[model samples]
Target: MTYKSDSHIRNPEDFGKVVVIYGGNSNEREISLESGQSVLSSLKKSGIDAFGWDPNQESIKYILNQDIDRAFIALHGANGEDGRIQGLLDFLNIPFTGSGMFSSAIAMSKVLSKKIFLEHNLPTPKFKVIRTLKDLKKATDIFGFPIVLKPNSEGSSLGMSKISKLNELEDAYKAATEFDDVLLAEEFIQGKEITVTILKNKTLPTIRVKTNRTFYDYFAKYKSNKTEYICPGTSDISEEKIYADIALEAFEALHCRGWGRVDFMCEKNSIPKILEINTVPGMTKKSLVPMSAQCKGINFETLCWTILETSF
Candidate 1:
């Protein structure tokens, strides 16, 4: 499938002093820094007056005094992807790239995203919200072995674990709860790990991720060099379209605007189950969105410019 470049903005002057917000207090701070730097470099290369802002090192209120016209969010995890910054941007009447407050908050939480997906009759892995050890035990009993435990509001698969036995349950739960009070114990779907990138409400292409590690954890996402990405993940056009169609539906169901990425787990001869939506996906070198976008001939600088167009 061919994807037309969405780069409609011809002048960097149109952006008028853009700030790439990233490196917050979230555990994904390091990754966000990398993403922010990459985006900052691209935006500058495209001749945009872009700057990097790390809320962790400086006060967020300083942004208001900087006369910044808009923001290109590179932050991940809490305070970033969870809508706090989006709310601030909305309150300040400053347009930013990616989804608004409500959608960002909903998309950041795996529990909430799953609820919305189920309500829309979208296929998603069965999950139980766990607040206590008893709740974890109950979920384990229901889902049996080989279940997945993850923090509800974290991203980049941090504090996420796939348990293959009962002995690993306590450790997984302990690890996940460190990130968020609420946890999601989900039924692990053994299948192809697929992701779809959506830009300006259009699905770019599907990507299949292969990793030697136990699932796509934080290490596999950023550190592992062995990870392989397959663009247009499916072999047939019909299958690819099916994935793309469902991905767009899922994005709309979450009320997500601008750009985002929809994740899925697809088993052979079965429907793909939606995992979650990423409102502000990574812009790092190893990120999936850029890889999928590149497959459609959208270079990094042009992609950054196109995403900045979403701010308008």
Candidate 2:
């Protein structure tokens, strides 16, 4: 990915001593480690004073003692992206990148986010919360076969399954429930998978994802080489604007800030439905945010710098 030259860079000393927070005890620790390391290296390459700190292996006091001015959060899932760490940082009076506490909390919950989307008439897929066997039965009655089952708060597509029949529902539900007490059974929309990247309150570019696997599961997202990402997904400028508008609306509806990504499933006839919002998107080599950003003339290093600038 290549980026055109621009004037977005700031003085290195403006960042002070920065800590790239990643690799928590969350299920996404490995991916967080990769993203955090990538971010740390990028910040250093950009001439910023940056260091990596893993909350799982280090104490908060150690980080506080480092005299860090701000944090570039790369942690994913659970205590990381779900507002726990955001609250901690707020209490510490340190500015960090990405959404604030409440927005992060809402974005982390699939059920709550979808509920807000539905209430606001945002174009999200129909869903039902599955907690008991009776709730599962209700969901089957509502969505029937070919539904999606996944945990409410996990990221990186973890604990997600597509159910095609009644016989498969129980196993899929079991798999999802093992990850979170709150699971969601959603109507399956067969279409092209796409995502919109938001940076500094501006929509960067749209990415259309095509995967050979069952769906954009964990493997297809991070590990599989077969997955392809296409930027500027549509040929028509108006259609792209429509998708961008909806993505921006969804981001604002959740009160998101700094930077993030909104995913969509474009159904037949080019109708886009909001899937979910990613508050702290992956920065790994295979991550989509950078792919989308690159299409907008923002290289990985420049992207990290731009995101870090949000701390102010």
TM-score of 1: 0.96
Error of 1 at 247 (Å): 0.8
CA lDDT for candidate 1:
0.89
CA-lDDT, candidates in order: 0.89, 0.87
Off by over 4 Å in 2: 1-9
Error of 2 at 184 (Å): 0.6
Model 2 agreement with the true structure over 1-312: per-residue lDDT tens digits: 111222254599867888999999999999999999999999999899999999999999879788878889999998888999999988887778888899999999998998888888899988888897568778888888888888999998898999887888778878888899889888899998889998877787788899888899999988888988888887678888988899999999999888999999988895699989999999999999999888998899989998988873
- Scored against the true structure, residue 82 in model 2 reaches a CA lDDT of 91
lDDT by residue for model 1 (1-312), tens: 112224366788967889999899898899899999999999998888988889999896678678888789999988999889999988888878888899999999898999999999999999999999889889989999889998899899988999998888788888988989999999989989999999987888799999999899888888889999999899889999998999999999999988999999988899999999999999999999999999999999888888888883
How accurate locally is residue 157 in candidate 2, as Cα lDDT from 0 to 100? 84
Instruction: TM-score each candidate.
Output: 0.96, 0.96
Candidate 1: where are CA atoms >4 Å away? 1-7
* Backbone collisions counted per model: 0, 0
